[model samples]
Target: MMQLQAEDFGSWDNPALDRATWMDIGDNCGELDVAIHRAAARGDVAELSRLLDTPHDINARCSSENSALHWAIVADKTEAVRFLLSRGADPSLRGRGGSDGREGDDAALCAARFERVSVMEVLIASGVGIYSETLGFAVISKNMDMIRLLVGTMRYDFTDMPRLQALEGILPAAVRTWSLESVQYLMEELKYDASTISTNNQGVLNLALLAIFNQEDVHDQLVETESDKDWGVAIQIIQLLVAAGASVNAVDDWVARTPLHFALQLQYPPSELIDYLLVHNADVNVPNHMGRTPFFQLLTRSDATEEMVRRFQRLGGSLDVMDDEKNTPLHLVKRPEIASLLLVSGADPASKNKYGQTPLHQASCVGDIGVIAQLLDYGADIEAKDSSGQTPLLAAMSYARCSGFWEKDTRTINFLLERGANVAAFNRDGQSATQLIDLKGYHINNLGKLALKVGHHVRQTQDNREEENVVDLW
Candidate 1:
């Protein structure tokens, strides 16, 4: 072994770095380390030979605890990884020393994941089983060159690997940067589970939802490939997972919402997907972690279509279903059209939420005089108060955040005042509607309060049979 200093080889430059006469057999391990380094830098295969012949340990662990082969493979130096592999540098050696429980920790998979296509090809041709965790990184990165080299050229089984599970939820996140065609390329070409039939990870669902939200071309693909599809393609994805032994009721961890419930809660229309879930027997009443039922989720809609409303009705949904706060679907009706639907569906206009405030109180807050009149015609209480004893008119005024956005119905306010909705009626805070407005004084006049009381009685009498329809709201 040569005891030469680093300066001896300081100016040493290789021309072919081959099986020539310049075999430096100094410190065997030291020379081997330097040989691997030079081989990596110049892609010289013969320099590696001279070092192997010079008596260095091919499997020597470097200072980082990785063997020479580990660093070489990780750097994706094909000649070095191959040379070490050929020289009995164990391919199963952990790049970082293996933990007591872990099995088969190789650096070739890491190289493949990072887009070292050549190195992956070399390792695969040498008979390394593709590691799924490393393969997940490759799939998520969408390194098609590396993916093809691993699967197509090497004949690696995509479904056989357990690490592919990690990629299930990651592919969707790539859409923020990659094209829809890229996502489709993975889905259609690589079979990366566009339907995600195997994993419970929400990454696939999130990507699908986002694709729809962004109106990506994958949405068109989902629609285009709908023939012979179950639960629509969207719902069928879940259904297929279920049929393939995936959980049908798998609630997502982030929102704690099942796929069916999420379909109802989304702002954009779900179209056939919603129908597919219902037809496939998805639990319509499944509540989210927040205790909000799918019915309440649907009720949160502002611009909900008539079709959505009718579908909820047809799905055996009860109008009386309450949210955590005890607010029924009727309490959330913002438009007169929805109010009419709720009323005709037998929603009690006078029913209170958990707050003991009726749908009338919420309608008042909306300040839609038309909806207020419709509620009144449907027998809403004129003098109903919440747990705080505040009247509907006062409830409406409390939520007026902007200067003019609320613009309360003066006609309805006056009508309620006339019907004996006491102008002096104070809530638990002892604030009256007139005082909430910082008025000059108690403007509680008698004439307005009288008209409100008369209209209330007349409307109540007209809807005497509302009790009859309540049982049929389901």
Candidate 2:
């Protein structure tokens, strides 16, 4: 029965106004305030009754565009909201606050965000049901307590929402606000079961990756916690996951990569962690989603020296293995020192990736004349054609515009041409090298022909984009 004060009446846009004036007087008949007159915000009954007695509408909207009923419902003022409803206020009316008009959904979300359990209860009793937005609000609130209540007590389905399902690897934005007590409550007291983690769904590893990148301290803490377990806890977790019948060789279904692929890509993993996985017989040769084998990845680094190379070799890693593209380790080596070790260790220069292009094709494309010479010395094939029927020299020409090659590249070009690379060889399009160069507006030369090929690929990509013009910015 609180009285609406004089200050409550003012402009609807203003948050503070005289509540009594807004309730008792119509704006056209007399000056009426809106902001303070909101039933939920004012919580004043005498002013509300006075306004009801006047020609002024009981459900008049405030500056925020919310009717008095909308305000009371959102604020969880049940009695005030009920009184307004009994006087013919619409309980289902939407407000300017949230886009959704179902006052129940928006208010429940706000309540979850504020951690107002009582408010949430009152809203539920008033007929609000769980929805995607509310579930998301709970996660974004980082109120694990609220999530537990919603899931356990309210029987909300945790896996039903697509947004929640897509949140793999990314920590809830609100995780930063979680207290240590909250963390303990989730991991220990509630005994929340993390799914049997595989690389597919955002599993424990995905969480670990985000933690490592976003909040290093949390990552360090998790690492420390695992260190105390038998089997080097994390390693054991992975092992147990595999042993409990998770796929040890589960190549990433999307990229066909294995978990080992990600571990190696991290650039700085715990040495002990790496050693632990290796000791447990993790496949060092497993390829990832991109079809890149572990051995191929190791050879990609300029920093990998004799010792690292030797360790991998000693570990029985294959050097000639190719990814889905058939790219051999020997094909990508730029360091002469590493190349020497590779040959001495029996690396195959004639090996090809799925594309059927050999190490010589790769070396020439990079304009690495030194590597080219070394491969030739070891009897590498220069006339190899990929599935596209393009030769080493043709492939090299396609990339000539990317980097400046030494004038001596003519000798390599002439060598391949003379060795049957087909100076006039047409690609899959049946266009001769000369014709391709002419069509692309470049002079008829090896490099010029390569430019034409690049232009062709660009045009193809552009066409694809134009066909799918409705791009999602999000």
Candidate 3:
């Protein structure tokens, strides 16, 4: 649920809307340089010449401390920019940065943002300095002409202090555009390494692979009926990055999750994305920091495929890999098909998690009767005990008290009774299934009836066994 704004960089049509929403007429503009600023905005060089008597008037600050030069650059008035620069207008003044930005951008950065190549040329001629951040603005905005002016204007020793840092940093921002041109420009033209990481320790390849998810905090984009994400350009973007030397197994610093993990954890995982990563020799069962493998995440989804399980297994996916909680992938099985798949793939049905809960215990809590049947078929002990000494049947009964229709299924008790779950079983808490149901007014008539039926069945089976062992005089 980490809120991500990865698409905020490239979803803009107007340059002004993208960067200068802060210049929306703040307090105190009475002594405004209205005439000069208007002339610059109109690209009126003659009017600019007529109004300017000295440097004070020519470089006067307007809304947000933006000068006539900044206004002219934003308006794409190249000739007016030249006229102002001739009158000694300083191009280094920075306006007050809007929200979501730092202390504002310089005239050089502003021009780069609007893609004013000629105006930037004029600024360069007037001794205005370019920066690594300026190149960032050009790359993120997808302005090729501005990119050319900056890169071509100065043989910017791309290896220098800030330029190298800037180029490396732009890799993630380029990925944010979800556009090939943006990312390709950096990797191919600017020579930014495909392996570069953002400041948050996310590798470029990891960011690219995760672009299919467009959520902030809510995963509304992932609430799919049957995997609706197009991923046409998105997958290709990831492919391009991988081809450019991005590592397929790039792991994050936070959770140690590789791209394969992302593909598996989120819903509607693109088959192409999974196959592409596998083809690149991504570690098949690379566990996250908590020991949850991509395979573990895969089975959590209801849509897990047989081929997907086999593909991961063929690549060395471990079926019984235990997480930090000591729960194996099979221990969290939610579907009968998946349970059968994991069991056939060599999962340990009797394996215990940290709480001593087996797969049967987990199935009992969720009340998935199908999964219970599958686990029992695969040799899950019906009488298995957890740390509480609770049998699977007891675990199921206790879980019904788990508040409001969750963590226990009402249907499971019936199935377990049919499977002959022992009613004589008692947990370490000294509570049998019937005692548990009556503990806190949680007992319902249906469960009480089922409990009585199980007790009668147990006694009936005991009497049958006693009769078989008796001397048959007849």
Candidate of highest TM-score: 3
The numbered model that scores best in lDDT is 3
| Root-mean-square deviation per candidate | 13.5, 13.6, 8.9
* Better candidate number, 1 or 3, judged by TM-score: 3
Error of 2 at 111 (Å): 3.0
Instruction: Supply the TM-score for candidate 2.
Output: 0.52
Please give the CA lDDT of all the candidate structures: 0.55, 0.52, 0.68
Native-to-model Cα distance after best TM-score fit, residue 336 in candidate 2, in Å = 4.3
1 or 3, greater by lDDT: 3
How high is each candidate's TM-score? 0.61, 0.52, 0.77
Q: What ranking emerges by lDDT with the best candidate at the front?
A: 3, 1, 2
The TM-score between candidate 1 and the true structure equals: 0.61
lDDT of 2 by residue, 1-474 (tens): 233333342222223223223233333322224633454555566677677877867667654445675455434465665566457664444444333443432445545544555555555555544454554456555566665565445543333354334233123222233233333333332232345433443343334222222232222122223332332344544543333334444454444545555455554545675565566565778766556676667677666567766777777888757665667778788776777778777888877777787888887777676677778777777666877887777777666645565444544554444334544666776766444433433323344335434443322122223322221100
Model 1: lDDT to the true structure: 0.55
Residue 240, candidate 2: C-alpha displacement in angstroms: 12
Tens-place lDDT digits, model 1, residues 1-474: 122333432232223222112222243433434445545334466876787788877666543344666555534567777877887777666543234654434665546433567778788888776555565555556676765565456555443454344345444443432334344443443354435543544445444444322232221112223223233344434443333333445565544565566555544545776666667666667666666766666665677666777887787766767776777877877667877888898888877888888988887776766677788888788778898787887776565533255324444555556545555567677776656544421122245535534543311123233342211000
